[model samples]
Target: MVTPAVSGGDLARVAIVGASLGGMSTASGLRGHGFDGEIVMVEAEAELPPDRPPLSKQVLTGEWPLERARQPGSATLDELGVDLRFGRRAVRLDVATRTLTLDDHETVSADAVVLATGSAARRPPIPGIDRPGVHLLRTGADAAALRAGLAATPQRVLIVGAGFIGLEVAGSARELGLPVTVVEAFATPASRVLPPAIGMALAAAAVDAGVDLRTDTSVEALLGPGVEGAAGGDGDAPVAGALLSDGTTLAADLVLVAVGAVPASGWLSDTPGIDLDDGVLADATAMAAPGVAVVGDLARWWHRGAGGFVRVEHWDNAIEMGRYVGARLMARDDAEPYTPVPWMWSNQFGAKFQLAGHVSPDDALTWIDGTPEDRAWVGVTHDGTTVKSVMGYNRNPKVMRIRMRMDGPDGLALVDLLAAESTQ
Candidate 1:
């Protein structure tokens, strides 16, 4: 129920909250859509430089630099005449007043507001969780801190969760000559994202990297045996020891939690009608509130074709959604909704994994390229009769083919095409 705010007149002010991937994408999208009105961007992160997924993969492994991972869009804002507030986290949203309140008690007025505040890495809830050696890679600072920890004499490192982040960390840790152990609640790494068959391949890569993997294992608790001979025993949140469900206690000099992240939605507490189900609710047009619309991760609006509002947290979704939101804001006329194919990538153990389309848990999976033993292949997920998604390991060409079939209704035939290629 978006309030039809027929007010605000010609000087409609649009405020986009966030400085990271979501914030930058939203602001840039507005400009691309020909939005000439006043546009303001709010972000709490320290730097405007982009810190992408590669920072956790290649940056820590001495392959890429801090300067290389930046978003490469701050200069574009100046050219687009966008006002940016860097290093300031917006804490509240007053939809009635069309005002966004910041943690610093600053109130920003706008006719439309988009909450594109993205997500951060989650830390395991445990005592001494904030210990000196315990690290969570959410920002550039976190990655830098973890990098420094790895440089030390390389004691036993414990990583909780074998998802994309966890596996990537384990790969890097092993590559650096550090003894690492990975504990996952699921039987295989990335089981939630990929089918069990495909996930087995990813798990093998982690094992190949000398990662001690404990499947179907959960940490009953995080314990702090206290840092070895530290000056003082400040138990605090810093953890030095962890207790597993199997009654095993491991001495951990360094522990990393790469579980997962959710959208930061504390600011949208009372801002209803914008779609707050998992994220801010909005349509394909990115419209949330009356004059306000949302794009990127926070826009949780549904799609008729996909069957629901998908707040996809991937690289392509952010860019594609932002482009749609921006173009609609500028057109000032009837515009088509965005129905983009979701795509994401992860680099681990010298392997590159890419995916296109939305492959859900309920979707039927059929392997089409490479083989499980070969450590390489492409897979497609079907929605009964149509190819809904395509995933691959070192298979970009196949990924491209699936991308072409995404918007068309004839995608169901993709499954046959992939099966033929797989046999070849």
Candidate 2:
């Protein structure tokens, strides 16, 4: 069954069970690289997949239509001779036989399989969270519904988390003149993703934009519009307010729960040879099992350059990983190891925050340009003397420039690089 794409001879068939950005990219890459095989992409969602990042910003803000947000090169799937099965869910994977059973009882067997089912938004265990006005945005439909709700002119909007999505949504709400209140258990917005100083600066940016940023705050329960003990509306109401852990109730016409997301890997539970921790355990080349590759958010692969295993959720990482895996599958010789300089950007509170490479909050951060108070800076992280990561707060050009020179022997020193680049 191994073809030149997978091992040598010509590949006959390949099946991708996801139809997400990664899946789309993999399919395109396979065909583009002369792998004249029968490519099939199965997707659970009825509508064709769209770029998800815009779901929180432009799509919700009515600046971009859903159709406009379709994944890049999506239209050429048909031209590439790909069989796209929409609304088809992969229920089980039989690795022994290399077969995938769909929900409709149809089985698609292929020489190689790529699992990119992506992730689903996490819904916390808050009481009354199932109320009509409480929403979670993850998909296109979710974004549309949230936008429709916002169109009704809500008195106040309460967001349950201060992650990237939560803050972006709050910014969108403020743009619509809706009073936005963000409740985060952490001390600052984007605390988990960015350095503490950068996170605090982002929190200030949100507040400056008229957001009622509530850090160190947790929503104990969601009160219904009609609950007996709930504040505001009676039993007929949808969601009236949220009860906070600090003994207070915040009235809201709509509540968005942006806690986070979990990998959508339940279908691969019984599949042999595929290690699943938080995601599908794959090698640097995204090889999950023999003839099986995993990408996107559901792949936790050993990064050759990073010196560790990381599961990146950014759009760029998904595209790059998919392309790398596709090329690896097609080549007769083993392709170069998958070691990407991961990059991601967030649009929050009318600022563009771009990050290149990886950095933990514990890493030593040296501000290369501007101050946290100025809300614009380029920062670099180091592991003792070697540069580990770089971040830009409204410094996209500098970040892009600095990231280019980050992979050499002399590039280990961040302070020297900053000094040299500043003079340029």
Candidate 3:
């Protein structure tokens, strides 16, 4: 990395690292919005980028072929005049001179730089986490390894953590005719996000699909890879079983960890004047540096509804925030501000879940629809009667109309609209 005191520029020579969703989207969006400045992208991967979301879902299940997931060609990049430095890893950033040094020692300079490198999967410190039959999904390799393990049609599977990833894995395992048991330290599936009632319903769905759901438990240690369980899955203590923190044991041949992810902002930690919180901090406009900006899961800006700084890690946030950051970059004024409602989706069973707006951490959650027992549900999150957020499970259209209503006055009058959708 080029280390210097400070550099000066009016507009900017922009460089984006990580050709992931946020980075590529920002490059494409900026050009679309008429940014004429010289732009370059640094991608760390060896081959052309492959789609990530499918790696854990359709790709692993053989529902979709791998080629379908590859990102579109650089024709878009070429049309936008983006110089893509592929196969180069960005090792460090020098905030003093505003330059990034690649693994090859080649330095790229930018007046403003956005750190959109997303997070990685966390690994357990246990002795056997690195052994075969254990899986962690974040990159394609991790998913591919887990996919190979699942291909054998093992009778038993063990999943750690019931967060989005873990549940998705359990759902996939069940789909493949495996008897899966999920172990979560939390009390319920997605306990962090959903209410107790909703979480139980979700857990029940997994159980209904033949999952041996174990909640409020954690793995104390992982045993040797050589010890396959009685069911022939990777075993602990001669039989594939996990030493649970509660003095209990659960057996399975395969183990998957899906606890959570930390922000991929460690490289920028030494970069001076860069505001670092849960992720790189951004102002209302998503600007963390003058002539520079941040977006996607890595950009932690103040969420109005949440009343605090939060990093919204969802596909929509990455896309919408990238577009806004690009537009702001192209405007050449660094003045216009844009904000979008945070939204995310998960397709586990035949159900789809969606949330619009930010839900307060401590906000009171009222059922717009009755409760999670119904396959379809909606919750109106309130901050003193002003509906800050409206979340739905299979009621997206109703949520859309409610958002329209909140922005208008019809929403307050048409509170009865939720009742009809609740029965679905």
- Model 1 agreement with the true structure over 84-108: per-residue lDDT tens digits: 8888888877776778888889999
TM-score of 3: 0.87
Q: Residue 349 in model 1: shift from native, Å?
A: 0.4
Query: Distance from true position, residue 319, model 2, in Å?
Result: 1.0
In the range 1-424, model 3's lDDT, one tens digit per residue, is: 1112112334457788777778877877777776678777887776556666677678778787766676544446567777877789888877656688988999999866766787777776755565567778887667777888889776578888987778787778777778888998888887877656667777877787777888888887665534333223443333255677787656566888888777888777767768788888877777776545777878898654445677888876777787777766655554444445566666665566666766644567778765677778787776555666677778878777766665432224324544554566
What is the alpha-carbon lDDT of model 3 when measured against the actual structure?
0.71
Sort by TM-score, best first.
Answer: 2, 1, 3
Which clashing pairs does model 3 show? 229-240, 233-253, 234-253, 235-240
lDDT per prediction?
A: 0.73, 0.83, 0.71
Residue 116 local lDDT, model 2: 87
RMSD of each: 3.3, 2.6, 4.7
TM-score per candidate: 0.90, 0.94, 0.87
Q: Candidate 1 at residue 175, lDDT? A: 78
Candidate 1, residue 93: how far the Cα is off, in Å: 1.9
- Model 3: how far residue 81 lies from native, Å: 3.0
